[model samples]
Target: MPAGVTTEGCPDSIHQMEVERDDTHSLKRSMSTMQLTMIGVGGTVGTGIFFILSEAVPEAGPGVLVSFLIAAAVAGLTVLCYAELASTIPSSGSSYSYTYATMGELAAFAVGACLILEYGVSAAAVAVGWSEYLNLLLNNLFGIQFPDALSAAPDAGGIINLPAVILVVLCMLLLLRGASESARANAIMVFIKIGVLGVFAAIALTGFNADHFANFAPEGMHGISIAAGSLFFSFIGLDAVATTGDEVKDPKKTIPRALILALGIVTLVYVVVAFAALGAQSAEDFEGQKASLATIVQGVVGSTWPGTLLAVGAVISIFSVTLICMYGQTRILYSMGRDGLVPPVFAKVSPKRSIPLVNTFIVSGAVAILAGLLPLGILADLTSIGTLSAFALVSIGVMVLRRTAPDMHRGFRVPGYPVTPILSVAACIYVISGLHALTLQAFVGWISVALVFYFLWSRKHSELARLQAQAENLTGDQV
Candidate 1:
């Protein structure tokens, strides 16, 4: 029998059964490497770059540039491991699917719970970010902004973020239409985001000052490490490329190519944008700016028009991020549902649209609630913790799969094998350690709830258990 194949009944064989059942309901494989790369760019280049500098720069000063590079290296290493796993198991669940096939149900469930933060909460974070940019755009264009009472989250002294809720609803509607449509929209948004950022960098660089670099390392090495940890959140969406392995035209080749392509593109953009911003203004100026890029542009251009343009781009780009992140969350849950780890309604695809309609709606609703009620700072930190945990698992899973199933066909293998995986894991741990204690506690609590659900509900209702029972009955009949 093949490595993934089982003789009569085994827990691991459930994936094969699920794959077989998915013939009729599988996602459409219409996306190419270009679209996949764009999706990665779209998913990653959201609020982290747009809003993170205000927080990170205050910690690392101008040396935050190095932090961006360090974070990119960590992201790059993880992307390599992800490419290998994605090719090995061309499923839509991303790390959750990879872990389920290689690890077990409980592990996958825990990872899925963390992924809720990575994708779902990140979507909420991005939506809130979109709302801020929308407010900036409105203020710049018409000299009017949403009253803080309606525009801000309760924690931020507002009742609810109506614009964020509206953005989530809009993305949800776009996603319900279909994957191909969403991918196309994402690609378009990616271009707009890059173009606008390019414009900002160009304009900002023209006013570059040597004075900003004078106090570069004032915060020392510790600050740089802290900034890198925060910047890690910016690189969260690279795995979005791997998650669409099932939706790509050529899983093996396309997934790996797209992963690297996306990583390189995103890293370059981040470095360039960071350099330009630092050069245009002193690091201290970014301390409390809500919309850092817009502020940078406005100062450089000496006008509100350019700032408005950047805000418009951010609004569009972050909307795509929310769309892709929400799409990822639903698919992960859909896979969990198929494995009987969650309710079946989550796995059911809409016949007309061929998308997980119910799951998407559930994710959108949850995301809207989070976006409407929570502040961006906490949401971003929580997203970082979830992403770091899930990414660490992917690194470990690569080494485990390589050792256990050395013969498995891998489309892209990590370059240094054990060393690369070791570094990836270590890097993830280092970054995770820098996360706020509260974020860690919240993550622990969240995972405990998921595990409790697994033991009390999922274990009994698991499809794997049913297969084992059927196999036992067959053996008894033979006896």
Candidate 2:
């Protein structure tokens, strides 16, 4: 038996070796810096910007601009840690993989469960938002749209959200084709969305009124803080860049570079859009505006054409968001399956396309159900809770790895080290504290379910445990 091998559970299991070999041969390394950056953009810039104002503006009034800045700053700190870990770790599970390699199996399971919320439910939320924009587009172009019974969830006085479900299924089909194809599609959507936002900014600026700034902080600092927590949903997908580390060219450089670049660009866009929207109308008017950005555009341009263009852009771009988010969910589960934390079927790679087709299908099906049945506000709030929890864990993992494996080779180190990670953790805690009581309750219920599954199932079936038993018996024979 090798010196490090024991029944206590070795760090390097046989299954992991096989998984690594498969990954080397299967997963394609075709993502350049540009592709990677756009993936992050595609993931992060969807519902958060297009539909979030209705919720955020009511919370923070005109001061939501400050919320955007605060959310960006916290996201910035968190992704710096993600860049370092993604560069250091060789797994594709995003924070879950990093936690496993640097922290431990238990922590990895918890993080993985939280990620289900971040990526899976987040996809559902984006799909729901996409449905709204799709309806907006239809109404703008032909003066016709789906009835409430066909377009909304049951809770929202509708039968089913057909468009959201359909969108998820379409993305599922594209993903089954493989990663490269999906990446290309995502790149196209990214450009269309950004271009539309640019046009919106130009038209919105035309109606800018200085008087709207009179009562900027009507709700004070507490409102701004709470609003930042709600707005955190917009920033959830920035770490998708890190999740692609395994498939990216020169990941060491590309991962961190793309993280910073995407974060900066996204933050700037959010700030500009928020400013433009606030200038065009009163903060109180944002509430209950179904398609907020389009409504803002209509107010500014005094016509429906510009709003229609913006809606069309949102409908096009949010498709990419759903695709990428579901992709992230599958890849994370794929890594867990390889590690024996979940069923092996999840880790199974297609021989022809080199993609996890089954996993993708499962994720799409689940997301479609959620998108069709659940309310958007609930999905977004749940996503924020899960994402913030995962970010907090990753931040803590940075400090833990520094103490436990100081010699590990890292492509990029957190610039401020202890301070940055500490601040990241603190920031996550603050935002999480501001979430609604119902959101917290749902998160706790979900975590309880995940932990129960781990204890009764994943822990016993873990490959590392099996390998440890074999190593112990072999060592006895040698003695």
Candidate 3:
């Protein structure tokens, strides 16, 4: 046996070699910095800015602006850690792959579970939000809208959310086509969404009222913190850039550049849109406002045309969000499947398309079911908790890799080193702490289920374990 192969499970020389081999042979490196950045921005901006204000504004009142900054701060810190790790140890699994290389297989599986929850549930949540705007757009243009039974989830007093399910299925088809195709589609949507938001800000500022600022912090700092937790769902796209590590061209340089660029674009758009929306309407009025941005615009201009335009933009932009979210989820599962942490079917790529066909289908089906049955609020909260946990792990992984493999070549180093990662971890924890007790409880239960699966199945079937056993047998035969 080669000295690089070892029974010890830490990612040593052999593991790095295997990862490189997989990168070279498995996924195509077709994504450029611009394509990847659009993926990040597309995955992020629509979900929160389009409809999340309805949920977040109620929690923080006029102070939801602070909530946006709070979430952005945490996301900023975590993306730095992601940039460093992605350049240092590129993988399709994102944080889960980072944890495996630095921490070991079991810990990696836990992070994988968190990521599954984050991307999968967030995809469904975004689709549900998409359905709202789709309904509004239809009503505006054609004077027709789906009945509540077809447009809403069961929890929202409907039989099933048909539009949401249809959206997920459409994204699945895009993903099945190929990565580059999806990125191209995403880029077009990103540009349209940005233009729409710019229009919204312009129109909304016309009605800017000073009184909205009168009770800015009505719910205080605690409320701001809670809203930040919910708003963190908006930032999941920043890390979605890292999940394309294996599929991005020159990932070492491309991933970090994309992460920073996407972060800047997303944060700027979010703050501008939130400020404009708040200025146009009182914080109290934001609550329960479906298709909130469009409604705000209509009120400002006293014309349905402006609102209809915004609704058109929301419908198109939110589709890109759902597409990228599902893309990220499938890539993560592909990595896990390759490592024997999940079923092998997830690892299977199409010979012609070079994409995970079965995996995309499975993810789409599951997300479709979730989007059809559950309310958006529940899906968003669950996604936030899961995403925060994964972000925390990535920050910790940076520190662990520094200590364990100090000599590893890093394409980009975090500027502040230990302080940066520590702060990232702290920020994630603080936001997570502000989540509702029910959310925390649900996350705990999810983790428990993951651990049980890890023990009974993943640990035994782990690719690392199989390799270790083979190495030991070879050594014994040599002896």
Candidate 4:
């Protein structure tokens, strides 16, 4: 084994050969430009604008509209950095994979730890939020409620999140069936989300009393910044488009175009939705109606049908979001396994489906437990910090690659060079600083677990042993 690299499980089960990748190990680049765009939109449009917007609008006041733009700018900068890295590398495992190949094994292990929280928590949070809307749509359309007693948590005053767990299980099944849902499904979901949001904006525009704008900056700039911190999580998934490297067709051309297109669409929809929502109701109303935007719609529209329809759309869209987040999580683990930072079991693909089953199962189980047990607000905050930290890494990696491996052929280059990536890092830090003190404490607590594991286990058994052995052989040959 290498001096610093380590692992948690058996490392000698497989030969310590420095494996070389060929065309087969590579992903079949079959996704079209349009499909790639769908992924970015699909990952971004779900749950965030539909559900979180209603929750955040109250915090930022009408200025939450401005918070939308602030969050988008930060996300857009990170997406640019991701675009460069994805095109230059053209592989899976997103950040962990990139860091391993460029930074080293220790960095990779630590990154994999953070990624587990980012995608996994995002998926679980969306599932829990989806469950809330599902219950709302059901009770309005039907007469029976799932009852708060069993629908939520004991802490939040519910028993078991049966709906959330069920949805997570269903998404896991879909992923296991050898059917990797394509990016087009995302585009369609984006259409539904946007179309419904458009209707929501149009209708709300009619009831637009300027009175809603009277205390627009009620929370003030500081409050808006704090609200933007909350909104940041909703924008976290945009980079999933960059994460699906090998799966994308003509990555150089398709990747950049898709990222920009998706960012534009997502930002427009979020800002418009926040504006219309604040117009329809006051910020004070958002706190009590935290679960679903439907309650807000009911207050404004007087009938339950519009709100019910909105709930139906959110339920459908959030289900897909759960799937994508889990998909990214598993792929990241699989990449780490393939790199020998963890166990090779994670890299072991199902011969029948070409999917990493072990990694998928592990992620699904953890996410299910989390969504079923934790409060929605805690999960949301945890996911935001994890994602921002990851985005910050990718941004710096892009800049480093520009310097260290300047000759490496890049399919896409971040426009404005150093300026863009610098701003990306700065923006991520700014929002991260705004995190509630409790959120910061929890994030520190979560990452400490990963660091401890890396130093204690992963470093001792890392695949970097293979690289060390090769170096030794070269020295012997020279002698």
Candidate 5:
């Protein structure tokens, strides 16, 4: 038949099965570009911008401005590259699906593994950050601490992370009720987060002290690059907008435009917020003031309630982020499982909930433990590395698909074509180059785990193989 059209029941047939497999349970192609833009805006704009400012600024001084610009530039190239691939592929599972259609089931599985880590760690990291702000809101509003033993991660001197666990469970419920909620809720939260940051901006700019910028780049360009590595995590959710291909109308025009719109909006917000925060407080103060956005706000507004309101806004924004990231992680894994990369159960969406229930629970269990155990800096590094790598792959996939399936219907094309994808890869590597050696080791560890899964189970048992074999045998027999 036509390309991307699968002939049923063939081993080694992933190339043929792409369109066929998604025929069932795939979402309706009904999302407007605006809706899709909001989805990306929703996922990418929260936790990192809200909570990461304090964590990142201290490393780069006011030179954190350069760091934000660097991260945004890298993400923009990836978004252009992603825009093309998502339209060509036009399906879910984000990078995992893109890799599958362009590469092979094996490459797809490894990408799936990486995406799982990216989305999963992202969800947990956001959750942990959410918890910090939640605790902050509680402490300021009611003088209640939720018992530090329960609020903190167990290893962090808490018995149970009730807030984190409760939030995960809460997000699970929301996701089960509606996948679309992830996007819509995310849009509203993005505005709130932007608004709060705006208030910070209005005040901080008025009192803007050029003195705080005197030591800009104090840690040197190396420090600013390291800060870029950290800030890159904030850009993670920008691609979630591309995942709406199955539901997006006129994806070629819609996807690319939306990608640009969402990226531009998110970058502007992030950069301005970082600048305002740097002006309001020194970068060195960020690490010590992790959950202190409200504290910084109070410095600007000169009112306890403004800080309280900001904390509440952060809590709301973070909760929504945790929910959306958790949902995205489970769905990516479910897509891989359906292709036979992991256990078939991962592909089995709950008849009751319509979610990939087994995958959700499994991912939830893993991330919960991570949230309860890992330090914030370590988790942020791991997430940034995974996302950068995935973005690079999607960028490269555009070139691969262009050469391999030259006539493929493309709804969107990267403007500069070949050169853009190449530069996208180069830029991702540049930011990744700035990552710490230890973080690189952790990323290597994660990749090794994914490859082990690929060789052990995914390669031979893959659904793609079965379909491919069947197709080849039929073609030979007919001849």
Candidate 6:
């Protein structure tokens, strides 16, 4: 029989899964808990808090605060499931790997496609947000701005979003250098983001008016739920910690700690910032505002300097979010490549640099094009739906794994076990149902394409499937 196969069949055991990781070309384990935690924070905190208020507040009024909490709760439950799976089967593919070990190849492929939409398209959406802030910073500080033809997407009345494209390229270059360098840069950016948010909160709170709370839930529960669906986009990066399992030191302990720590920090910052922003201005003002946080600060302080500071901070910090999102996308592709689900070039790591250089280039190029050509609103809705679907699958995978491999050594276990995972799935489904009808249609279309590719191409070339076939053939010969 082939290695990792049993007399009965190809079992989804840890040993069998280990056979998939090629030891000679594996990711370098240089990241610490702090770096991993920072990656999670860096990936998540910027675009959602910095720019999403403009989109979410209009949907829920002042009650967008409840939307933030709802989104965070769903994210928190999924994070618990992620922690358990990452501890039990530490790998680079995040939910894709978890699904594979617990479910099967087809399910893993579907989850991988969802991850592509979540990370790749999300990076594009974030880059667009960064562009908004960059333009604001430039106009405030230098009295100059890119022409709408160069700075906005075609759908948004521009030929292309050049700054967003440029930002993606810069991140790709940094990623090409190595993970350590990328993590260090991300750590610094995360601190800057947190500090800038703090300053905005402090300044904005000074102008808080109790009148803003008079009609808080003006749109009712339906509006709040829809806003929560949009706000869920903000929480997309928490699972990024799980993606670094293969690269972080002592992943079992490191991943769970990073996931929880990152979630706590993000949820607190989001709520505080939401409170400060909403208190400073009426919910109606958030609609169609670019660089909304900075605008809020400007209104509250009645000065250009404070808003300029916020814009500058946004431009810097949102870059970190794009970088980490792109990083996550490339790593997921690398994992898929190793499984023969995509082209082999994606799995090729640079021996000297200890990074997937080609993979980074491919992912960055695609993300840059999307950022430059597509409008941010569509990109964000697509990202939110894809992320929620992937989260739901991961939560289900946790329950499946517990039954299939109950003896697996998990360094961290979900405190509530079955209940927690069940809630995680339900929460994801609830939020997903609140998304726009068009978003749901687009997601279904994307998943259908993925399934087609899996059946026609991936199923034939899949490494795990090939191994199973070999084992079965050998067993038949012996009989």
TM for every model, in the order presented, reads 0.92, 0.91, 0.91, 0.87, 0.88, 0.92
Instruction: Please tell me which predicted candidate would have the highest lDDT against the true structure.
Output: 6
Off by over 4 Å in 5: 1-18, 28-30, 54-63, 209-226, 247-252, 278-292, 350-357, 372-381
> Cα lDDT for residue 325, model 1?
91
lDDT of each: 0.84, 0.83, 0.86, 0.74, 0.74, 0.87
Candidate 6 lDDT tens digits, 288-324 = 9987888888887778888778877788788998999
Which tens-of-lDDT digit does each residue in 144-229 have in candidate 3?
98999998877678999999999998999899889999999999999998998999999999999988989988889989988987
Model 4 Cα lDDT, one tens digit per residue, 275-365: 7777777677777465355666666778878787787788878977887788788778777777667787877777666567777788889
Q: Decide which is better by TM-score, 1 or 5.
A: 1
- Model 1, poorest ten-residue lDDT window? 1-10
Cα RMSD for candidates in order: 2.8, 3.7, 3.4, 5.6, 3.5, 3.1
lDDT of 1 at 337: 84
Off by over 4 Å in 4: 1-27, 51-60, 147-150, 154-159, 178-184, 209-224, 278-300
Model 1 per-residue lDDT tens digits across residues 199-234:
999999999998999988787998998898888878
What is candidate 3's CA lDDT for residue 184?
94
Tell me the tens digit of each residue's lDDT in model 2 across 1-479. Answer: 21221212323532353346345444666788888888898899886688788899989988999999998988999999998877666456888987886677888899999998889988998899889888877887788988999889999999999999999999998888877788888999988889899888888889999899889889999899888887876888887777775577777688888888999989999999899989898998988898788888887878878877877888887898898899899989988887788998898887778787788878888999999999898787788788888899889988887776676567899998899999999999987887779889989999999999999999998866677788899999999
